[model samples]
Target chain A: MSVTAPKGFKASGVAAGLKTSGNLDVALLLNDGPDATAAGVFTANRVKAAPVLWSQQVLKGRAVRAVVLNAGGANACTGPAGFQDTHRTAEHVAAKLGGMGPGQVAVCSTGLIGERLPMANLLSGVDSAVRKLERTGGDDAALAIMTTDTRPKTTVVEGDGWTVGGMAKGAGMLAPAMATMLCVITTDASAGGDALHEALTQACRVTFDRLDSDGCMSTNDTVLLLASGASGVEPTQEELTEAVTKACHDLAQQLLDDAEGHTKKITIEVVGAADEQDAVEVARSIARNNLVKCALFGNDPNWGRILAAVGTTSAQFESDELNVAINGVWVCRGGAAAEDRSKVDLSGENISIVVDLNAGKQTATVWTNDLSHAYVHENSAYSS
Target chain B: MSVTAPKGFKASGVAAGLKTSGNLDVALLLNDGPDATAAGVFTANRVKAAPVLWSQQVLKGRAVRAVVLNAGGANACTGPAGFQDTHRTAEHVAAKLGGMGPGQVAVCSTGLIGERLPMANLLSGVDSAVRKLERTGGDDAALAIMTTDTRPKTTVVEGDGWTVGGMAKGAGMLAPAMATMLCVITTDASAGGDALHEALTQACRVTFDRLDSDGCMSTNDTVLLLASGASGVEPTQEELTEAVTKACHDLAQQLLDDAEGHTKKITIEVVGAADEQDAVEVARSIARNNLVKCALFGNDPNWGRILAAVGTTSAQFESDELNVAINGVWVCRGGAAAEDRSKVDLSGENISIVVDLNAGKQTATVWTNDLSHAYVHENSAYSS
Candidate 1:
């Protein structure tokens, strides 16, 4: 029970024939609410998918009652016809839910871009999903939104009397701003649309925004949060933000662990920067360097490549004063070799690289995965 | 004859103990010139190598007699000791040349970083190279600078009476501002340091600066141009720029063809941009996209990935007005699927992708290589 872990929410998934494998590919999440309030975040890619455009318009109302998602055709770069398809999808969801307008329904799509959806099959699937909706169908909904992901990701955080829970699906095309994913979070706590939006923004900034798996942004990335007010618990903004952040963090970690063909989950911590933005820039540069990623994959403590990557950024730092540590061993100190690199073990699945700028007292962390043969194979052989 | 094709130049290559394989690892190029006017360009990365620092200082005087380049130890990130090593190498070269000072000798090094060079072996290798220098030794000089390069890159362009000849060595870690390579070009044309610098800068701006193989800038990229005035020909700046550009273009193409573990050489041309910088930014973004590289490697006409990369840039363009052609087939027109993707064949070693922003008249081109499993294997298996 991910999104359904909260009260007054029901969800279900059904096979839509959109996926050739005949897997469950359509998910419907409904808020049977005393109050229907929602907030959303989307991909920064300007060439957004049809569903993303539709959802952005729906979010303007901030009173969504349901969300419909699919994992087959991206419905991106398909021109006006694709936008109509997304509008039809939302209209179908709203009509099946009874007494709701199309503006109260959000739409999301994933998979190959520049393709149209099978409208007949998708509409029938939505009908099936709505009829089968149950309080405990969150797992099925989670499984339905997967494209390349190997497993369903879900997390729950308990409040005083309410609960926040979320589900996400992503395996490739992950990068900063947000991963190529579709996530829906639901809570029974009472909150206004502005508060929910604020909490979600704050939660996503430090959680999902720091993950740069493949350094590729997607055309259809969306995260949604809904409130039902069934628990009648009105937590303060701080409490709501804390619980939402916890749920987002848990889901983000799941995405990282399940990233496509990744052998290691690397966390880069950048410290001693002039400001947080500087630290973030430095960490992102290191995270995206293919040479550094390859060296880490080979378990080589190649501090030189790391330093070279750091030098590419405009972040404030003296080259000779930089320090880098791998697994608690300072392999590079003052821009030169300090400790024996052999002492740093990288055979484990989890790796930590710490870069100290020695500039000031601001810090940031970015997460990434190694570039492996499997990564190259999976990305090249398939068209995901 | 490469660099020696120009009059008043002699070069030699000698094997040193620095390379365990006993291959030629040191090269010496001496200008037997009546006039020694030179201009140079180094890596833009702030964390530069010891050789780059020394070479920059030498170039300040705008006069140089000889250049000593070695492969097998980059002499980078070794702190003050590395600087001392580079200084000592220059001084030794100057001493061997009789009346020249250390400031007239430029030094270049390539290979593994973050380590000290074998001073005794390197000095001995330098002495041997100086003694063996001959007018026809340019080919051997090119061979000595190989790190992962499979062949020597040399080119010569004939002017009215003078000539411009160059040799370059690089296999990986290629990116803009400049590639991770060292180059030396010699000319017999009569030109001052200011004119030589202007010509070199203009030529490189359109040639070597546009090749981005792996998106990794080096700490030791250097390009030097030396004028000897041996032919007694003073060509116009336009003529000099054209010949130098031709040599740089030929050498850059050779580097792209020999890039480490590459299967296909890709040229991305971005047209209809608001300005040249916008075009260049768009082209480089597409050139460095690993997903785009992988798709091309697998012979998949995945135009969506190319479009997605273009959307990441701030180049002025309406998403719906964008167009892309792969191998002369317009797969994406008006930002949507127009022609059949199957029409585009990617089975050859050379691939061309054209992106039309439909925004302005400016255009730019960038060259790159496809990301392959061999790239991962080579980079991960070795410490380079």
Candidate 2:
């Protein structure tokens, strides 16, 4: 019960001919509410997909009755024809849902980019999904959005008398400013569009925006939050933001766990920074260092590579005043070898690397995965 | 003949016990000149090695008579003891050269970081190298400076009565602002320190500075140019710069050919940019993109990945007006699929990707390599 955990929401998933595997490739989420308030965030990549451009326009109207998402082809780089395909998809969804205006429906697509979607099959899938929409169809909707993901990611957070539910799908191309992923959230609390956008912006800033899987941004990243004020529970703005943050954090962790071809889930925690930005910059530099990632995969506590990565950042830290600890072992102190490297055990899936810049007191954490042979194989063997 | 191809230079290579394999790990290059004029460039990495710091100080003295390079250990992240080891090595080289000042001797070290050098073996090897130095020892000196490089990189360019010759060694951790490699160039032209410095700077700005293999900057990258003034020919600054640039370009190409685990040497050329910096920024963004590299390794002309990389830069270009070609096949035109991707051939070892911004008249190019399974294997299986 991801999106359906909230009140006055229905969802369904159905198979379309868009994916050659004949798997469920289309999903629809409907908001049957007295209040239809929504907010969204999109990829920062300048070359965005047609669906992303369409969804941005829909959200600007400050009302969204439903969402239509597919996992077969990313309608990107197909020129104006691609934008027309997205418009037609939204219109088809609106017609199937009792002939509502196309502006009330948002669309999203994820798969191989620079390809057009099969309109006839997608329209038929949307018709079937509208007919099958039910309160308990959220699980099927979660499964329909998966491309390379091995499992579905969903979470629910309970408030005093309301609930927030969300689902996300991503496997690779995961980096800051949003990964190559799609997400949808539903809340049954009495909040306006401003409150929902504020909560989502704040939550994603700390969660999805800190995940740097490969340091490659995507062109079709999207996250949507729909509030259907059917629970009659008017929670405070702070309360709503807190619950949304928790839900986003849970979903982000799930994405990290299922990252493609990853054996080790690494967490780089930077402390004693001059400011939060400095901490983030330093952490990101370490997260994106392929040499450091390879060393972690080999279970070698090579603090020298980590220090070299730190040096690439313009963060405030003296080279001779820095220290690093891996899995509770201080392998390096004051920018040089201190404790024996053999004391650090990296034979686990969860590895923690802590960097202490003996500067002011500011901290940040970034999540990433170790680079491995499987990562190269998965990325090279397949086009996606 | 590489460094010793000039008129007044003698060099030798000797095995040092610092390397467990007992390979030729120590090299000495002496400028037996009536006038010694030199210039040097080091790594841009803020966390520099002990040898780099020592060499930077020595270059400021406006006279460098000799250079001692070792390939067994980097002598980096080893704290004050590492600096002392470098100082001691320089002093020993000076003493072996008949009591010359230690400040006139420069040092370079490459290999695994965070390890102390075996001073006794290194000094003994230095003594042997000084005694064995000859005008025909350039090939041995080139061999001594190699860590994982399979072949020696050397080139010669003739300029009227003067000549410029150079040698380089590097296999990985190659990026802009200097690769992890070390290079030494010798010139037999009559020039002062200022002219040599200006020519050397201009030569490197367009050659070594454009080769980015793995995007990992090393803490120990050094390139030195020494003029012996033995040719007795005063060439114009343009002539000197032209000759030095040719030698550097040849050596840079050699480094690219020998990049570790690379199946394809890629050249990303950006044209029609608003300025040179924009072209370089766009080219580097595509060069450093792992997705693009992986796609190339798989022999797939995935132009969407290339377009996405181009979008990541803040270069001057309209999304709809941008174009890209893979090996002369216009795979993407006007930001959409154009020529059949099947027409593009990627079976060769050399690949060229051109991105046209259609925004201006400036252009630039960056060199990189495809990511392969061997890359992951080499980086993971070895400590370096």
Candidate 3:
């Protein structure tokens, strides 16, 4: 099985005795002192986890030899003690690999927020993870990082003398520019750290930030990149851009597919807005509507709810400039509803709504799901 | 049942077949002028209903004689046709009463949005309602305006030379005060429409506007003030001020209690902020969090989720200056957390979170409820 997959990369995933189900929970990836460069992104949440804080500080130097991660408990709200656990884990991995210092390892943790990590279990887990590192280990590592995701998410985009392989973990609390996605990308491409960071940020702008389903931000969210220069080829900017976009697109879909209790991924397209931001806000406002989500779950054709949601936005458009189309059928025009609403079929798993502001040429698309009883059930009974 | 609840006011509630359920759905109130004065408010939604548009036009003049209301379908998004519906409903009641034109009769309707009024049923309802009008008819009228509301809402406050009585109808999509309240306030204090409109607007600033739970803005929200000059002694402005404040406080609670799927009313208090809006945005963000609501429903002491929500707002508080108190117990301070988390007891129904920004003296309070499966059930099942 490809664990640290992508050409010229080494990865490992181990049980670590952290999960009650004995599932794999700790993973490691090493770049092996390559000319390849690294880049990353982390949650905007102020309540950063111990691992997130530690990794962010290390990444400031922009050079890392390896990446280490664990799941099951987020080292958030754990104070100084949690920070120590993260440093020790990185140290253990570095000592075992013998090619870098603790500062050269980027660390990330995901899962239940505000919980303390079991240092006793993690200490041994890090050592075993380093010992088990191997090529094609990306599959196991992807599985190891998951919390509530129904399946593992892994993608690899091959380039000349380099490869960009990534994995992600997330489901609910998703919205645009990205939800609580904890992503890791590994490439043997020889690019500078600053350049890599810049590229990753650009890719995240549209791919990850546009998904907001539950509208909650997680404390343990993170994204990291590690490069091993074994590929012996420096790729052009164009090649890197194309590869990164493809990888981001793949990982985003993976996250969407695993959205908790979601049976359908509806795309809300807001067209003819004053600008792109207005379209985004209007679509997002509708996407975040609980009533509309519930209506969708029930498979009811409630177009009024859609208009009401759009109306609540503080955006530039009002009732006068609004025109609405659902599934390519115009239901409202010139500030009034279309006389022909019966032509639209809203009772389906896939629902599409287009709001034309008649103000600008820019448009925005937002992905969301209907509110379902299963969502309520999953969240309500989750802790118990 | 003591429906003409306000002193110096006369009201009547009667059967209106506009609703297919054969329930009473029309209400009338008469204020023969005031010894003191009257006031009014309206919804902030840009997509105003026919009645809202008409009532707003009338508000430009300020003096109101009577208010006529019915509940079956909200005449919103009906375009030119919708305005005609509001006109005919008022005209029917005015002709039967033999006192004024349609312009003098304020109108309100609440039920399903986007649907047109059943003219045949409405015309008959208006005739029967006029014949049944009486001074003691406030409670039935309260019941008539309810759509998803489980019960009618009515409150009364007595003033010198006039008695202020009020009735409101809204259970969903309520975050009133920038309007969004379908309310009828009656008094015999003898005031003109301009003064009344000013007071009504002022009172609503804190009362109706502060009660945002669902975040949805209704197209048909309106609040009408009728002055019946039965009271000979004119009350002072100070007296009206006190009455309006008290009315708002009580009604805000009523709206909170009536919020959808709310088994528990959670108050989020953000204190020590730089300003009121900053505190308000922080509290509002937390109140609007679906994950936080679900966690509350599960009785999970998820303060981390609470802080995460606060960080997302534009509030002027930093993580380091944050101090969190759940159910009156301080659990976090500075940039880390304390062991007092055990003090939070969400084991019961009501949950209260006190976040002391410790950064400023500003404060704001927001009310919300836990997300429950029953809420999903109710909204998903309802149509028209």
Candidate 4:
């Protein structure tokens, strides 16, 4: 099944006994003669899934017309058998696409790790999926990527001379330093595979890797962007870059907003840092902190924990170089709170923080959320 | 005031206007005689607090008569002002102790970081505390170190020759790798300062450092053990080591059990690793994963998340060398579960996980809990 969105990419989704819920588990996206230029991003985690391995290997110097993705069993850590499952899935897709080699088709799977695929059900599912492809089946492809995601995530953005569309699935947080999330973007722009690759990589770093609500990187995370040039409009480099970045930022935000049990989104802005890297190092560390997360939940405006969290990092801005702001109000400066904390409203469900390191000009903003009881409730409940 | 406990040491607790709660915030313990045989362990985070700075410099080559502690504000990141507060706090305590000098006392402050002390109230609290010294105020002193802790944490382990007493406070996991807690231990067993220091260091490794919960190390974290020699009998080297080790282990467990929002404790046992460190590295990486934490929260038995988490570490174990078990039940081996998840339950709040490296005999156990909504609620609602 396909996890891509491209013009002429007719897709179909079906439930073939892969998931116990009997929900749509197989999705196939097919491209006819005018195949869109393909660029994909796979998980950065060193331990790759079988399908991730297959896709990464396949996308090296070739363009693909289809992608096959299944939900229920992540073909990871299953050793040789896992690799075979990916190969077979690729072969099935390529064969269905008029005898192309398995190398032309990418595959992705997400679900319980360390499990084998029941070939009987999967093969039947693939056949059924291919037979029902349609030109406007973007909605069906979205259903195929669901694991624990409560809702299907899709985004369509229209830009000058082109349109950028995408979908992502991740119920929990993906660490900004490469999180656990599977994203697929389709753009009808006239660009070569290499250009799409560069755009996709650059876009993934700023868009997908900058979000760290829970700091959990999944093994099966993949983001594939297929540029089908079906729109017949050659967009400028600057416009393509901007459009890609904007879409990625939008998708990342949507994922954070829809993160399981997320009640409030907290923005951690690190300003005047020694560099963008250090600023990010400081802000993201605070974002991933469990105590800081809890404090946000309590809306206590416990700035002390924020300082403490920053102190934990290697970036040492002199104590005096540190200035902290909550929301739009400057609460702390020159190392301590600027005003009486009793007047600050830290109890709001939505929290914003800005920390300035009076050392440099580079700044970074990180999106996170307060850790809450509902988070525990949803996570501790039985698996679907 | 004093921060000591002796067979005959007197202690007192008083309110210092630092904490808005108006609860007991200052505590002092006095040995009353020559008790220079002391040892300490401090936070390894490099970013040291004022009291930690003072104590490390003073304790470098001197002995002390009392330990003075305040619970409201941590004099950290206050630039030169923070150091001044520590000096004044020590001086005030010394003055109240009649002929004692500032050098004869030690001070500890726990609460908001980057805040200045209310000098007037702090000095007054010291004076009042000195006048009300008694031998039974150890418990109250324990309460003074609390920040968001749900209870007073104090442990007294009576051994053959002396009593090893300790008090610690960390609602959010204290920093480990250095020390993630403020533990003041008092013992009557006779031992040299160097010997005591040696014992404390050796005992802390597996006990304190191994108990990595939230993995955030505080600037003010310290473990001070004082020997008053009130027992009149010097302990053997072996006996001293055993006592300190036991005390450290017991307190570490307590900290784990009291981890914030943790309804159940999960023990990750990574066995058969190539080496002990490899086993530990793999386990620690998993322990820090929020997705695994949430998965544990859900009781989903998503061993894939566990495998994915372990694989993220720098350990040398290959997928083939890895074997994972949860709650004494082997779920994933040779990279995948047995394809029978019917008995698996990811819905329970209390869960256990064990990962086997299957390559060597060395094993490491990491204690952690699932991330919960309560954790979020408390952190987000904290003071600004």
Candidate 5:
């Protein structure tokens, strides 16, 4: 139950012989709509990918009919030719979808940047996916966009008379600004462009934005939401936002769980900050610290590295007032040693770290993964 | 030749029980005064160690008689008690040196943070070091202040009629705003306090300030310059600065070559930027990127990662006009793949990366080490 769990949506995935392994690398999602409303978020990186630039322009129309994604080539930094390839790919998908205009289609790609896509293979695969589009193909679509991710990530949230569903793919190069990920979310609730944008923004701000598996922000991160009012149930804005956020949170958790070479998933909860922004900043700083992540991998409750990372941030907190707890044990209190390090158990796959800034009432939680030898191996050998 | 290469300086290193390994963990550098003009730079970390705080105050007096260093504990985040320990250590060293004032002593420590120093063992070691102090003890003094360093780092610069000699120790937790390092530089030049301060500032601005080993800034980074004027050579401010910068650059290069768990030394040169600040910013962003570092470790000419990193900075550069070269191969020209990636060889211990923005004429170079599994292993297992 994923993107297709919502009404008026069909998805498919197929191998295009583009990936060297001959794995499924092409995915398509279609909105069979009486009314199509869309919203999207793209990478904040200044060097936007060709597909991201194309999709941003397409979303300006506030309507979308189809989404075509390929994983064998990222289609980024390929100059004007890259943008032309994206335009042709979108137009091809629109033409194959029975008279839909090019402006109604979105194109996304992930993999090696600075390389041209195999247009023949990608276009043929798009046609195959459009022909095989089925109501139960969401899982396959999720599996298709992955690079180094170990599993497909999909989630569905059911409302009283509406549904929201999503699928996301990413592993390495996962940081804020949505990571090196491609996400497709669908809803069957009656919503306009403004409502869709508001809901998607609110949903992603606390969900996908909080997952920082690594400190590397990608050049090709995109998340799109398509709403088809075919269900005839007009949900309120609050209800739509809640459902979308829940679905996104579920999918984001899956991404972290399946992140490359990670053995431990850490939930960093920063509390007692001056404000939510301060909490988020402090949490992000701690989450991105390689030394802290390495200690997490070794299961060595090293709170000193945690404090050292926090010190680097401009967040509100007195050095001596900070406290840290790992796996339910307060390892540091008042910035000094508190509980016994031996009391902290890190044998489980999930690690909980609580940092009390002791400044104010605001709080935030960021999710991250530990730095492991396998992470080094996967990334170092990835391009080769 | 090192810190002792300069006249009017005597250095010594002694083993203290502070280290469980019973290695040399204490060092003393005494400036024989005809004029003890001093200037120093310290870590920018807000959560500074007690010794840093003490040394900052000492530098304000523009005079220093001795420098005491320990390696077993950082004496950071230890609250007022840590400050008291640093204060007492300074006073003890000053007392043993024939009634020198505590304000004339600058104390430095590098090791585990959030721990108090063992006062009894540290003071005893200071006495022992003073008893063994000699003019030729620079190498021993360099060796004493090491935590995970593989070898002692020392440099000497011979001026027209004077000399600048220095010793530095740091292996990890090194970044701009100084590193988790400690250095003592002694010069036999005839310079006043203001000239010493200006020369030291100018020297460090381009030398120690440009090394970003890991993105982590330390709490105990301190660099001190003591001018004895014993050689009776009065050099120009420019000449003094050039010699000091050369000495610092030599030491900085040594630090990068001996960085913790690194198999290769990387020099990131960002040219054609709008200004030196922009160049430094762009270079630092690329240097700190884990993906780029990983690619370097694998000897992969992944210019895409370099471009992705440059995109994240606010540095002036057109997305399509950026160029990157690995070693001497222009792998990327005009932000697109130009040369064959296989032609770039990374078999050597030194790797040079050049990124051209084509926006201006300014340039900057920063040194860093690649991310390795050993880095994670050493840091994770360090505290345990």
Candidate 6:
């Protein structure tokens, strides 16, 4: 029970004939509530999809009665027709629910870009999903948004008097799928629209934003948060943020674990930097280096490549004073060889690399995956 | 003849037992001239190799008598000891040449970093190379600096009365062989230290610097230009710069052709940009996208990935006005699907991609290699 775990929420998943595999490709989440407030974040990329543009317009009202998501067609780069498709879907969802308009609905789509959505099939699927909305339909809804995801991802966090639950789908980690990360988080906390927006912003900043699977930012990345005051328990904004962050963190980890072709989920931590920004910059540079990722894949303690990646960043650090540790073994100390590299064990699913700049007291951590032959093969095989 | 094609240069390559394969791994180039004025460019990476540091110091003196190169170890990140080893190598070369100080001899090494060079074998090899130095030894010198390189790269540009000859070795394109690009250029033109420095900078900026194979900047990238003033003709700086640029362009292209595991040489051109800087930045961002490279490897005209890469850059461009052409076929126009993508042919070894921002009148070009399975296999097999 992903989104339906929250109070006063119902969902359903239906087959829309959008996916050639005949899988469930359309999902709907409805808030039958006394209060409906929502917040959303989208991809920073300038080339956004049609659903993203429509949802951004919907979010300006700060109230969402329902969300409609589909897989198999991204509806991106399709010009004005794509936007019209997204708008018509929202209008259909609103008409299915009495006393609601298109402004109260948010839309999301994921699949191949430069393709038109099958509006007839999708609108009929929306009607069928509304007829089948139930509390137990969240699991199917989670599975419906999957493109190449091997498994559905869901998480729930229990607060003292409120609950936060979410579902996410993305498997482009080691596969050639479009890998458009889409997530819908629901809560029964008594919060206003402004408070919900603030909470969601703070939650995603440390969770979803820290992930760099392939360094490929998509044009259709979206995360939505909806709150219904059905619990009747008013909590502080900080408390709500804490619970939401926990749920998002758990879901993001699931995405990383299910990333395509990745064998090791490596975590890079940078410490002793001038500030948080510098630390994050340094960590991101190391996490994105293909050479370092390849070395990790080979289980090789090649600290020189890590330092070389760090040198490319403008982060504050003295080259001769840097230190790197692989899997808790300090292989490089003071920018030179230290412990015997052969002693380090890398035959595990998780690897940790720590870089100490010896500059100041600031730190950051980033998560990434190793590059493998499987990754190259999957990504180059076809256009996902 | 490579570097020795110039009028006042002598070169020799010798086996130093540094390479496990017992191949020629040491090279020497001597400016046996009445005048020896030189300039050099080192890697922009802050964590440079010891030899890069030594060579930068040699260039500060504005004159070079000889250069020693090895291909078994890159003395990088080894602390002060690595610097000492580089200094000792330069001193050995100076002593072998007679009547020269260590400051007049430059050192360049390319191989695995974080290791020490074998001083005993390397010093003996220096003596042997000096004894065997001849005007026709340039080919041997070019072949000596091979780590993963399949063949030596040599280029010569003939001016009205002067000549520029260069030799380069780099195979880090898809492998982990340090990818340290080293080039030694010799010119018989009459040029001073300042003129040579200016010319070398301009030539490298548009040639070697524009090639981003795998987007990994090495710690041991060095390009040295030596002028012996052997040709009595005094050409203007513009004339000398044109010749040097031609030679650098040829050598940079050769390096791309010989890049590891690459089947296609891709040229990404960004036109109608806001400025030259923006054009170059946009071209580089696209060239470095793993998804874009993988599509090229598969011979698929996936224009969405290209536009997604462009959206990530800070360059100024309207999303709806961007146009991309693959192999002269306008696959995407005004950010929407245009001509038939299937019509674009990518089966050839050379692929051209053009992006028109339609914003301004500036242009830039970047060359890169497609990411292939062989690249992943080669890079992840070992820590070369």
Report how far residue A51 has shifted in candidate 6, in Å: 1.3
Error of 5 at B77 (Å): 1.2
Best by lDDT: 1
- Which order, best to worst by TM-score? 1, 5, 2, 6, 3, 4
| lDDT tens digits, residue span A124-167, model 1 | 99999999999999999999999889999999999999999899
- B-chain TM-score for every candidate: 0.99, 0.98, 0.93, 0.93, 0.98, 0.97
- By DockQ thresholds, what CAPRI class is model 2? medium
Q: Give the lowest summed-lDDT range of ten residues in model 2 chain A.
A: A172-181
**Counted clashes in each candidate structure:** 0, 0, 46, 68, 0, 3
Q: lDDT of all the models against the reference?
A: 0.91, 0.89, 0.75, 0.75, 0.89, 0.87
Winner by DockQ between candidate 6 and candidate 1: 1
Span of ten consecutive residues with least summed lDDT in model 2 chain B: B172-181
Tens digit of per-residue lDDT, candidate 4, span A39-117: 7776666667898888888778548778888898888878887899889888877787675678778888887667788
Question: Among the candidates, what TM-score does chain A have in each?
Answer: 0.99, 0.98, 0.93, 0.94, 0.98, 0.97
Give the per-residue lDDT of model 2 (tens digit) for B281-309.
99998888887888899998988888878
Q: Give per-model CA RMSD.
A: 1.1, 1.3, 2.5, 3.4, 1.2, 2.3
**CAPRI tier for the interface of model 1:** medium
Chain A TM-score, structure 6: 0.97
DockQ comparison, 1 vs 3, better candidate? 1
lDDT of 6 by residue, B107-138 (tens): 99988878888999999999999999999999
Cα displacement (angstroms), candidate 5, residue A6, comes to: 0.5
Question: Residue pairs in steric clash, candidate 2?
Answer: none
Cα deviation of A161, candidate 4, in Å: 3.6
Residue range B283-336, candidate 4, lDDT tens digits: 888888876776676666777777777767777666655667776677777766
Native-to-model Cα distance after best TM-score fit, residue A14 in candidate 2, in Å:
1.1
